[model samples]
Target: MTTTALGIREYKRGLTDLGNGAYAWLQPDGGWGWSNAGLVVDGDESLLVDTLFDKYLTAEMLGAMQRAEPAAAEIGWLVNTHSNGDHCNGNELVTGAEIVASKACAEEMAHESPAMMAKLMAHAPEMGEVGEFFLHCFGNFAFEGIEQRPPTRTFEGAFDIRVGDKDVHLQQVGPAHTAGDVLAWVPSERLVYTGDILFIEGHPILWAGPVQNWIDACDYIEGLDPALVVPGHGPITDLRGVRAVRDYLVYIRDEARKRYDAGMPVLEAARDISLADYDSWGDAERIAVNTSVLYKEFAGDHGPNDTQALFAMMAQLHKERRG
Candidate 1:
């Protein structure tokens, strides 16, 4: 295990046994497409939480889990925390496991397919700076030819299922990180696997939010009083990490609101906002997307975000920061 400057202990890449048959799959320098996943096991039954950005990564994770725990040889259920490609793109590899997700996540996944990603990567060379930024973020992952296997089971609000004698609770706490983000809670183990809800030391990109919903989601996770919190990215943390994320959201929301009231443009506000407090976080350029979403929310625009335009803004901001 390696510790960050902030004193957070980060585990090595692969399965970390969390005792009681709970394991976390961590990818170092958890930024962009490098995401984390979890495995919960009881007796001969096991439930897998999320997947990696591609089949190879997911296959590696599965292999590690199966080697560590015999129950993981055949996952009884695969729970996708959200619809992000990093979390659900490898769903096809789980085989016969009953893939489960939030109703909103399932719908979102239908549109954000691996084929779409492959197409984007194929055209990245022609897109100039935006494409460069895209390649920088996702180039390492293979998107071509991966089948999109959506959820076979979906629910709204909350759902409950069992893995052996332990009960795992699924709570839909989004329209925050994504349209339908879910938190998988193993009540008996006092453990919670938060999708992208908690980015730990990284800046979270708000693809869907009113900001308040994300804050409330953070509160809900805190309310659970979990002993072990496995975040979607970065190291395992407790309520402190959750509050840090919430604080960042609140800071950005208020800062963006002031700029909005002064009639500043979204891109300008994103660039102007002081990130001194969060300077240590990875992917600070995500402020471009977060600020843009907050500006739209302030304007009472509930429309879908112009993704390509956002990526362009992020590319510009990323370049500026690098310089």
Candidate 2:
């Protein structure tokens, strides 16, 4: 049977029963359907792994959760897996609850500002159709509405929170995908919410990594053998999904190494490499920047890539692909 795209459908939401008062909202067509946040609730209080990208999106998701397993208002804690706008942007939607995240993620959220995003969007008109098209998909979302509330309670190592009668463990596995990446493990539920650490059937973002650290996270996750692993993006998956990401990492790492050894330029090499195994992965083209980033790490090119340059690189490739 032909597969349906991960979008193009009303985002399916609400909790799937995982036993022990713990449940996860599996967003169908997980690509960009809505932020894949996990919910763990018990008789006394509740805990949210992450929030959606915007108020409208999150509000809808919040309502859905209430419908599936009513009484979400009693939620007491919220944990953001990282600073990526998609994962933590909807903080305002979680009313009356305390928001949480790693210190590094909190710091990264502080680094972004409405003025900066506004400046980027202001030039959208002149960027032509592709630019405007990009804006249309992203610009409608509000950046000004974002209120940067860093995690009130931050921890360097593992932290434990007893959710009513259950034990939910928060592990600090970061500096791999971001400065501070984390995963939520519910012992009783035997489930894991892997933020961007695990991207099933989608192009994994390697923005802040030694790559090997992300690989390590995959290895760590494999050891857990969670029954229902809620990936940062894509459909709910099993351990099989975890292996896909590991294989992608190995594929790209070897491909880039081959090019680097042959003394190929990063950008040109990006276009030339045939990523067949990862071809089905959403935004497979991101392999271009992924290659650039990994090559930079190998060569120690640690110079900062500010917004404009970052935009230019992505925009240029977007234009090329469209043409």
Candidate 3:
């Protein structure tokens, strides 16, 4: 199969050097917390786009990077694109680096501490449906030793900074995937590390959404026309990939809207929606959460999500799919 400069289609896990001081760390079958990260190097400085789910995973990525580029051993700037554990749980591993994130993301990070995951993992085996769903979604990572080091610096909108001599643009485009989602755009190299904004081959879970915001995020990516787009999950893609994601969101939103207007329950709508077109996408069970969020948004509800309930519903969807 043909591959893009930083594609992860062939590798389950590893780093791909995109040339000219940019690299992408891929974790394939990008399901659950299995996400991807990026590294930008210039002169003697290195900027880490995001970290992995746990310390060991982050260490392995860093070690691979260090071997490929000696300067990677000391990351000067660490950017957390969002508040997801897969992207920031390894922040503590970067010790002295100046960590940065959007103001909203930093706040979200605090609420989803590593201890939260530890607690969930600890009780997962005993909790029935919620536990089954939770473990099914997040059981792969080691959450015990994560120290939960959040970003030291925060920004509200677009910000520009340097990784050595390369200019990295941090653009906040969230309240979509999360409260704060940023895109790390290396304009000079024509590459963008789109933090959960683009999930290439997987169904993106809408933990937070207006749905339109997520669609707009894709438009923003296409507007940039980056040569390589490294998503928070899945392989690297170009403008076409961005369009696919946008199209999926648009399709689901329209489908869910019709059901919402008819007063269908969220779970029923999720189950009723045909995913035959997206059947090949990983994590098809996420349709449950996506439909639920879309339903809530359609009803003008902006309340906090009932995460456990959502997971239980997803668990049900998964079982149905399996059977």
Candidate 4:
């Protein structure tokens, strides 16, 4: 039992049983709250996907999973879909779980940890509104006690693991949202847990890729036609969910290309593109970052990704939002 601002009550993790001992967890409510994790469990063994932000929230997520399956006693595997802290932090809460993620994701995971985020935020909480939102959004969520345990195994392209009777497939589906993004496909359940590949209701941010890579990723996912698609953020969806993201990417790509041709500035292009389908997503202001990456892809921005530059572009977008 935990005490929330609302009141004290037993922690309830997220959406319950889908089938075949599979369950989905909707993290919490702020923004990182938008991120989700999953459980593939059987009687005695299980696998988990993408732990939440802090130790407390991750513990809550695990506690809920145990309630749903009780197999946390012996979770066979833990697969991280990407390098984002929201997806992989708080891993210390799960005892004896063999962690797994893409090689790229693993490498990136090492670059940042819960402790690191805590430290950075402690010093410059206002580095950017995104960082502030991260702090504010996750402020109530407990990460204070969590240990950062990254994956034990790393695969390059594809890998498969069996938990009791179910098979979990991990596919390296990145250079789209990040350098290395992976998706977990439970063959028997017809479900694909897309880390950041499918944001469902949220705007898709491109951190690493040629834009087309992510577009192709959406196409591959569409071709699979999975019955249940669990996004890194947002509720559970399906093939239609995947197509919606593909459409958004295609539209943005075309829109960005036109701006590139028309010689509009990156920030201007981000504001002008008009992402109608994704206006409902949180952080729609991220369009500037997307435009920056895509603009560089086409017109060539030779400078390395400056942290300052990224935030400036987003700050401009956030500023634009106020007007």
**Local distance difference test values of all predictions, in order:** 0.92, 0.73, 0.89, 0.76
TM-score computed on alpha carbons, candidate 4: 0.89
Q: Per-residue lDDT for 1-323 in model 1, tens only?
A: 22244333456787777878888999978899899999999999999999899999999999999999999989999999999999989999999899999999999988888898999999999999999999999999999989989999999999998999999999999989899999999999889999999998899999999799999999999999987889999988888899999999999999999999999988899989999999889999999999999989998999999999999999999999999
Better of 1 and 4 by lDDT: 1
Q: Which lDDT tens digits does candidate 4 get at residues 90-186?
A: 7777778788988888887777666665665665566666665445444655545457788899999899998887788888878788889998988
188-299 per-residue lDDT for model 2 (tens digits):
8678899988887787867777788888889988888776688888777777888888888878888898999899987777777786767666755467667877887788
Local lDDT at 253 for model 4: 87
User: In model 2, which residue pairs have backbone atoms overlapping below 3 Å?
Assistant: 6-29
User: Model 3 — TM-score against the truth?
Assistant: 0.96
**Best of the two (2, 3) by lDDT:** 3
- The weakest ten consecutive residues by lDDT in model 4 span 1-10
What TM value does model 2 have? 0.88
Measured with C-alpha atoms, the lDDT of residue 283 in candidate 4 is 74
Q: For model 3, what is the alpha-carbon lDDT of residue 174?
A: 95
Q: Best to worst by TM-score, what's the order?
A: 1, 3, 4, 2
The TM-scores of all predictions, comma-separated, are 0.97, 0.88, 0.96, 0.89
lDDT of 3 by residue, 109-159 (tens): 888888878988999999987788788888888899678888899999998
Candidate 2, superposed: residue stretches over 4 Å from native: 1-19, 26-28, 136-140
Off by over 4 Å in 1: 1-8
